[model samples]
Target: MRAGRLRGTLGSADRPASALGFRRVLAVFGALVLLVGAIAAFALTDQVWLGVLLGAAFVAACVNVYWVSRRLQHERPNR
Candidate 1:
C-alpha cells in the first residue's frame, strides 16, 4: 500500500540483504555463459543429446561450487 512497504504479513527480517557477494555472483554468471556456450557448440554439431548431458553436468558443477563456497565462507574469520 505504501511506497516502500509490502502487504505481506511477515514476522521479521533475519537474513542479510544479499546471499552472495559480487564475486560469487560473477562466478555464477560466468558459469552460465560457459554452459550456454557448451550447449550452443553441441547444437551446432547436431548433438542435442550431448548438449543435454552437458547441461546436467553444468548443474552438478554449479551445485558443487555452491557447496564449496558455503563451506569456505563458514570457515572464514569474520571481519
Candidate 2:
C-alpha cells in the first residue's frame, strides 16, 4: 500500500484561477483564429494543402486546450 501523501500542490492551484482561465480563453481564441485562417486559405488560395495543414493544427490546439482544462479541473489541492 502507498503510505506517503503527495508533497506539493498542483502548480495551477498555486496561481490565481483567473490567470489560468485567461490563458485558456486565449488559447481557444487562437485556435479559432487558426480555423478562420484555414477557411480563408481554403477559399482564397490555390494551396489546398495549406488549408488542410492549418485545419489539422487548429484541431490539435483545441484538443490540447481541452486536455489542459480537464487536467486542472481534476487536480486536488494538497492541504
Full-model lDDT for every candidate: 0.65, 0.77
Candidate 1: regions farther than 4 A off: 1-37, 77-79
User: Once superposed on the true structure, which residue ranges of model 2 sit more than 4 Å away at CA?
Assistant: 1-18, 75-79
lDDT of 1: 0.65
TM-scores, all candidates, are 0.50, 0.66
Q: Which one is best on lDDT?
A: 2
Query: Residue-wise lDDT of candidate 1 within 1-79, one digit each (tens)?
Result: 5577543433236322344455567667767876996778686878777777778877876886697578547644352
Q: What is the C-alpha RMSD of each candidate to the true structure, in Å?
A: 11.2, 5.4
Among the numbered candidates, top TM-score falls to 2
**Per-residue lDDT of candidate 2, residues 1-79 (tens digit):** 3456544444544432435556678778889999999999999999999999999999998997897677556653332
Assess the local accuracy of residue 15 in candidate 1 as a C-alpha lDDT between 0 and 100. Answer: 24
TM-score computed on alpha carbons, candidate 1: 0.50
